[model samples]
Target: MRSLIVSCNVTVDGFMAGLGNDLASLDFIVPDSEQENALAARFREVADTIVFGRQTFLDMEAYWTKVDSDMAAWINATPKVVLSTDSGADVSIWNNTTLAAGDGAERVRRLKASEGGGLVMFGGVQTIRSMIAADLVDEYWLKISPVAVGQGSSMFADLPERRSLTLRGAKGYPSGMLDVTYAK
Candidate 1:
């Protein structure tokens, strides 16, 4: 079975996106450096597939497709699964992409069983919460930024119950971000 990993960047206060539901506030964190580049490369190496919520998928598609870089190439080539209810939306605009509708948790369960590599989820908040509520995540790879965004969408909000995770490892970056890994 494949491991379902929730990989995201969060503020010290546990928010994923800052106020106004934008990531501009986080621009100060995770500065562009060799370390950040290597971390991204590491994620591309470990995860064979990228999973996204509807909004994030759309947003990423719009943004990443325009950029010309190795990460863009990897993301464009990667097999992607978007959990969405909007059947009318065209997921084919990108290559190696599919839309999974109805019973998100069950679809994720089947995907995990059918695959061998890691399934890394980037979020729009609601989708991650759904997986958490269903108790379906296997690991969390969070980069905790030093600054707190006071108000924004939190990474672990409205979890159905307590989720106990063991600390797998942690590393600090010169950019003042703590890369932490936790497993269930």
Candidate 2:
């Protein structure tokens, strides 16, 4: 089965974005920089599909689609399997992108078990959390920001049972971010 990895950037205080949905304060990612460039290159090289959420679909199309580089467009154009209820919207952000409208966890499990490239589930919080709760996620690539958000939208939610994970690797970035990789 292909590994299901949930990759997200969260603050030290456990917030994924601010209370009002503002994420600009966590200023670590530079879109067109060497870091983002290399990340995108590797993401394309490894991940077969990108799991996204409704909000992610909107945000990505709004930002990444209009980005100033091919890497950005590549990121935008890559296969995105979004979990959305709105099956009647404009989702033609890229050729491979598609909306897979129901049973997020079950659908994801089927995708992971099927033959394909590595599966990467981008953290659109709610959707990712749902997968986590369903015990469908195989790995987690979490980027922990240095700053603290008193209270805001969190990356992970409390599931019914405690899921197990082992830290496979950890790296401290120059921008005060800690990149941690965990495997189940």
Candidate 3:
């Protein structure tokens, strides 16, 4: 079976996005630091497949494809699966991308059962919520920045019940970002 991992940059207050579901709102966004970039590179090393929600897929395709960075290269070359309700979603704009519509949780479950390297998810809120609700996540790699947004959307907001996770590793960077990993 494959491992499904979620990588999120969250505020200290536990919000994934600020007002109006904007991650760029105010100083709520984590500052781009070398340590953070290094951490992301580490995450990229573990996952050969990237799982995304439709909006995130489009957003990333628009931005990453035009950039000239190692992350951009990895994203363009990696295989991606976007979960969306829109059957007409055009995934051809990006390389090695596929669209999976209907039963998000089941599709994720099926992916988890497939033979592959780690499956890592970036975001799109709704998709993360569904995966959390279905308990399909095997590991969570969270970079909790030192910022507090009093209110916003949370990945854990709609969880049906409390789920406990074991802290597998943690590292504190000078940028005040806590790079932590939790496993079920």
Which model scores highest in TM-score? 3
| Regions more than 4 Å wrong, model 1 | 19-28
Q: Rate the local accuracy (lDDT) of all candidates.
A: 0.81, 0.73, 0.83
Error of 3 at 144 (Å): 1.3
lDDT of 2 by residue, 96-180 (tens): 7887877888889889889988888775777877888888888887777677757877656556666678998887756676778
Give the better candidate number (2 or 3) by lDDT: 3
Better of 2 and 3 by TM-score: 3
Query: What is the clash tally of candidate 1?
Result: 0
Model 3 agreement with the true structure over 1-184: per-residue lDDT tens digits: 8899998878888888776567565356556556556765875778888999988888878889898776677778889999988888888988899988888889889998888888999877778888988889899988888998689888888877788999999988777888889998
Q: Estimate the overall C-alpha local distance difference test score of candidate 3.
A: 0.83
Flag the better candidate by TM-score, 1 or 3.
Answer: 3
Clashing pairs in 1: none
Ten contiguous residues with the weakest lDDT in model 2: 26-35
Residue-level error in angstroms, candidate 1, position 63: 2.3
> RMSD to native for every prediction?
2.1, 2.6, 1.8
Between the candidate structures 1 and 2, which one is better when assessed by TM-score?
Answer: 1
